[model samples]
Target: MSLNESCGVYGIYVEDGEALPYLYWGLLAQNHRGHQSHGFAALSDGIRLYRELGMIPALSGEELKTLMESLPGRLGIGNVRYTTSGSVDRESLRRNAMPVLERGSRRSIALSFNGNIVNMGELRSSLGLPEGLSDAHALNRLLLRALEEESSIQEAVKLCMDQVEGAYSTVCLIDDGTLLAFRDPLGIKPLCHGCGEGIKAFSSESVGLDINGLDYCGEVSPGELLWIEEGSLHRERVRHSGRRAFCAFEFAYFARPDSLFNDRYVYEARVQFGMNLAERFDDIASRCDIVISLPETANDAAYGFHIASGLPWEMATRRHRYVTQRAFISKAEERELILSRKVNILGRKIRGKRLAVIDDSIVRGDTTRSVVRRLRAAGAREIHLFITYPQIIGPCFYGIDMATYGELIGAWRTPEEIAEEIGADSVNYQPIDDYVKATGLSRDELCLGCVTRRYPTPMADEMAREMWERLRSSEREGGRIYEG
Candidate 1:
């Protein structure tokens, strides 16, 4: 399916010196987060920016050097956008590209955003914009309009939040020296701050900070605004909407293992998830001979699964770590073939074994089907598929683009049917209660809307109907259905 959420973002404010190289490295470290586009803006005497809708490594040696050298500022912001809300069509693609630059009353603002905004339609209608306005454009317009009346950039951001709703963790460069950063009231997306030398940086993942040798300050709290100028940072809690709901997917499937979320390590969380899964399936532990993980997102949970079950674990599938671009699988048939090619089965490890495969989640049955087929082909006596997350029975209305109910395999098929389709001896998913508990956060602090469809933000009936119609048309057009 066409994956919707983008990965990570990085921004820096360095003393009057070249910051593009640092921004480039930051983006490089975050390259896994987004491969579709890369861009950076620097402000020295004026705003100098460079961006292209392609992978970072795709830039020719000379092209890379030219963009790096041309960037003119000590203060800069960079974004790597993965299309989540819009289509990949040419017009939609261009509209979703980020570090959206705009000229404001006080100065120029180059905004780089990471998360999806759910209320774009309502916001557009309220702003009196055209019906066809994309979320990126609508957001840019809202930010600009807020700036028109507010005193400072931070105030403008707070005022803008009142108009739009949904998950957003954003960074904006205002004028040549000032930087503004904010996370949504729910803080469903991650945004963190770090300091290095005379440089201060903000990123969606802490790995960006570690790559740049920056000291982690802490995460930017929800409903807060940060302003950075001349290597110094100031913070103001503009809106005190204490309600916070961090996206659980960030820990389960999105953030880098080494990254930290809300002061908790992602790798640790996965280990905890595995521990919880082990306890839930304690009786099945002795029936499995070995535990194997579907790398690399499932590696941590697999590790946890192994430790909890006391099962001897081996790497049955080898992954080519360098493949960074999104694997485009157009059809279900093609998806199965591509998945098989992506992982190589170690016959010696799987032969004559009763294996347990630990995976992050089953968005669709294609990838899991391929993996199970390869394992059984290698003489695996039996295979049990364990998903770290519960069945995703509904679409995510917040930001994640999970397919509609009709397309979700879990929505129509039972566990037995899923097991049969995937050719597994049995299929088990983490219970929703256990999954929520594993995060060590309250229910209200997490968004389980993808699994339950009880969206935090109200989804109007008309919008839901429109989305359903779109899904139906997409099915007719033979587009990849985004089941979770």
Candidate 2:
């Protein structure tokens, strides 16, 4: 259950003046999407990029002044990366931190991408590709070639839509002062467009738009290309696979609770998840004395559980505000210590109680096991783990950090086995269909590849099968299966 967020993409187009402020706050607001690295490419007379190997810095003091002075432009693209693709060594992460900028003799464009390229291996062979180049770089190279061969940005993007496969929600800036945004034909990652008094922007999540005071327009649709020039927005349905496999994981885990998906707030969906659990597992509910949530992501669901089960929703777990980093993305040895420092238990309330612990999802099982260990030490009588999302039995190749079958606890073991492994009295997971219903989207509209192993795109489907087989045989497969 190694849960990891994909990435964040943001762009702003203004008539003239500094665009760095929007890019600054936009990235800051959605920093939860990625924290390993952050960068932005501004399109002035030429593209100017400022990127680093850690979180986006606070928007104040000399950092803000220096950032604004360094990258000044009317149109720009920004990204925060979580390393779903390419190497994670500091050198590789530093080299691959994007908006992956490509400067060519004919022309150039800066792109900030938010998804993985499933057909990367096949795509690379066609071009004289650079070793260790990231998916964003690969996609940018493909787009540059298409632009050289085609007549317009629209045509170039259409070619990209046809050739590139897998999850991608991209925002780019052309040298001609135009802002272009498009989602992969499947819309596997979330991206939305918004407009304010005199500004138009694209963001990975609506919270970014909200923070910047931009009115939410709508999502950049699957297979849709949004071209904005001067204040006009033009939309072209580039290619429709007719199957929109929006990543369902966003609602359950990654996306900010304030963000909207399919016009429904993510927090509301999470609340529904708790209600569903209470109704579906009444026996467990009746036995529990209180509902406790770990971190903030599970709080809404825990509250809903309290209402439905007639139990107290105890705010016993408190998170340290300064400890903003997630344990799943940190180093293995540091993860346990970070988790310990991040959360604290109010032992008086937890002691001598049958507690129902609600969580977003159990990815690698370490987080759950650690929390359970803390509760045990606090003298809890029994800890029943109620997971909001269904067990993820397969790996995610789209954009999440969970890329291999061997890393997923559910892939190798059942819920009962997971309960014993995590030291919980019982581990209850939501049914896939019920989880889908709670999101207010049909099964066809969401990508359930990690949960059901039925990937939306062709290449990912093939790769998952190959990886699953290799893992089944206990092969020593190192590195990401999708990357090869």
Candidate 3:
């Protein structure tokens, strides 16, 4: 299913006149995380922030040269973002694009951040910020307030961590040209740092590191604060908790397949998901004539399914390379167009065949329903869906696009009901136990918040409960409850 990706946060600390290259490539590599707007804040003399709407388009030689000339700095933070909160209008897009720079009386901060803030309403009121502001804005204001009052950056970060709740993996630029990066107390988002020669960088995903040829350093620990000053870096275990809740959806959908999380590439974990599905449904696997996968994310898993079931994996569906609009964040009209028009089914492989189709997840039921209809038209006798991720039964508040119970088809429907609605003969999902094993993380280590309805952060859990009540009574129609 289509789901909006988390924003990508990138930062660089390097020699004078050297930050642009890393910033440019880092955001470019992970542009899939966000395509609506992109920008960077560089501290050349003071912080210089520039942002533009739409995806980072292809550039010729002259365009690249001109962009580089405009942004000059030794260290900086950058972000490519899509709205999970706040306004969605054009003017708001420009106003809210990161890196968000804020200044107080004695201290200032420019930050590029990922993850959602669950206490946004209270945070906005406490900061006395205007309504409908983005989570990043509210967070930047809160952080700026802390930086102004606290003597040390670490202390300020700790205070900020204590105040804000939910997922946040951030990279910030300080006034003195120092760079700091940190993760939320529960680590609901991914961030990692690595150094190469004279350059040190942090990114929301490892694909950014791979693009810059940086060494593969591990994930930033939960609640750890890391800073780079004068090219020398120091680390502090700012906050510690017995539970860690990294977003499990990252392996299932949001993160790039090449990204390394918990030492295993996301693609590898997805492949294991396929193997696990095959094992669980060996009876169904035996009846399938061929296995096919939805193009893109589920390709590796389909390959694994083929290996496990010993069935030929047919390339039955082909995606339109030019259709790049993601279904989750697109307007309803645009989403249907993209989902239906973006892929075509090969009649030869599908006609008169019993098929086991592998896909990532079933969210709103639109994308899958459309695909099933296409396959039916192609003469498939029976369709069985093998989904990589477990069924998402609850709304996701930690930056995933799904934040409303009404929008989630799996929220109240049983597997049989979902299959009937989506035109699948059977719908099979990997057991949550095996899904956890594939990530190389224990069940308690990952944020199964959406699937299990147990949130790591207190505020998100409380707000989710309130929203659930509203949703049940049909009192709330749309939008995130935390956004209230």
Candidate 4:
């Protein structure tokens, strides 16, 4: 059984005007989050949903018009997804595509969600849901169950919040034209609300709202529910765990740089991450001749390193403009080919230079190794890696694809060992404290489970402990424990 996936979700409720256009642009802006599939759900007389494998296509004028005509509604939600959950085959990808719609005897509902459910097995047993259901399906079923038992949407959501475990940022569209959005008590994923003329919207990232000309309202607070009906938006604090465990990976890699959290742009935080790296690795900085990033995500950090270290930041590697999919999110079998075609190295510029190469993170070392080989072939005399995120030492019970100890290159190796394994002179990961400081968020407020091996949720923490013990022994670490 495949687990869950990290995805991007967008929902809009407009008092006037159609919601499809705004939802389209909103999801499009967040295409970087997931590339495997794109989908949309609109609420007209009833919910109309269209989902397909692959990114949202660049529609021609006529095609856009046809899409608009097909899904006419004043409220809608959209999703872009990549699988860490379910099967990755074409058939499964089509089956798992969202926004996921569930029909019941009394009412039907549509949902678009990000993050995983840690206690899915228990939930399934308790709710009597069958196996082979995607996390989104399980969640929707759980909500439907709650809705059947409760008197109001708020009460149902509160009950679900009390029962469900793990990271989830969700948006729901009820058949009665009600639009609802909520985050888990821990706020382990990103979800925010925005407003515009006669419109209220919810997106997994602030950049989504930015693209749609919406005013930045605020985050849908941890455990808070926001619903819109009869042209009015209502807020309710369903449950608060008295703490926040926002995913730190968002700032390190997943989110678009322009995304905002706590009034600070992710780009600015990444730049600060570079400065922190420079300060921490001054010795390495002194020895390096030039700095170059591993294309787009690391570009900001590379610039920050140059700014602080007085080194020249070289644009020695250029990403293919048309190759927009992220290698980190791609399947392992396809990653090497994608990276080879996605980035081009300017060999002449770095033919003899000792380069400080910046990157977001080194997951399995395939991407880093491939890039290092290309750099060596391009005549880079020396390569030193500066990683923005700390070393990932365990599986992520949330939504990240780093699922097993054996899959993570840094899980059993030190920085020096990893450097040797990846063909680099050195590997410098941003320190935990420095990373938190750079993000402008407190240490207790961020989730560092993948790096620290200390999860915020109870089940995840226990699962990691058991997985670690299995990995240490000769026992075969089976599939994702969450699925187990």
Highest lDDT scorer: 4
Q: Which stretches of candidate 2 lie over 4 Å from their true place?
A: 1-5, 473-484
What is the C-alpha lDDT profile of model 3 across 95-186, one tens digit per residue? 78888888888767888889888777677788888765577877788888887787888898999899888889999998887899999988
Runs of candidate 1 exceeding 4 Å displacement: 1-5, 58-65, 104-106, 126-133, 326-334, 460-484
Q: Considering only N, C-alpha and C atoms within 3 Å, which residue pairs clash in candidate 3?
A: none
* Cand. 1 TM to true fold: 0.89
By summed lDDT, which 10 consecutive residues of candidate 4 come out lowest? 475-484
Locate the minimum summed-lDDT window of 10 residues in model 3.
475-484
For each candidate in the order shown, give its overall lDDT on alpha carbons. Answer: 0.75, 0.86, 0.85, 0.89
Residue pairs clashing, model 1: 43-73, 403-482
Cα lDDT tens digits for candidate 1, 1-484: 2224454678888875677877887778777677667788888667776777766664576876787678877788898877654466666555556777777675677788777666666676777766434555566677877777767777788887776677778888777578878887778788999997788889988888888889989999888888886667899887766677787777778778898877778888888788778778877767999999887878889899888889988888787666443333234456666666667788998899988888888776777887888888889999988888788765665555454565567754678899998899988888888888777777888877666655565552344556657666877899745533
Query: Candidate 3's error at 268, in angstroms?
Result: 1.1
**lDDT per residue as tens, model 2, 1-484:** 1112368999998775678889989989998988899998887778888889888877666778788888988788899988753457898888788887876778788888888887777777786677777778888988888987899888899899888887889998877677899999989999999998778899999999999889999999999999888768889998878889999888878888999888899999999999999889999889999999987889999988898899988999999888888887666567788899999899999999999999989888887889999999999999999999899888888878778776778886889999999999999999998899999999999999999988998888888898887765554555433322
Listed in order, each prediction's TM-score against the native is 0.89, 0.95, 0.95, 0.96
By summed lDDT, the worst window of 10 consecutive residues in model 1 runs over 323-332
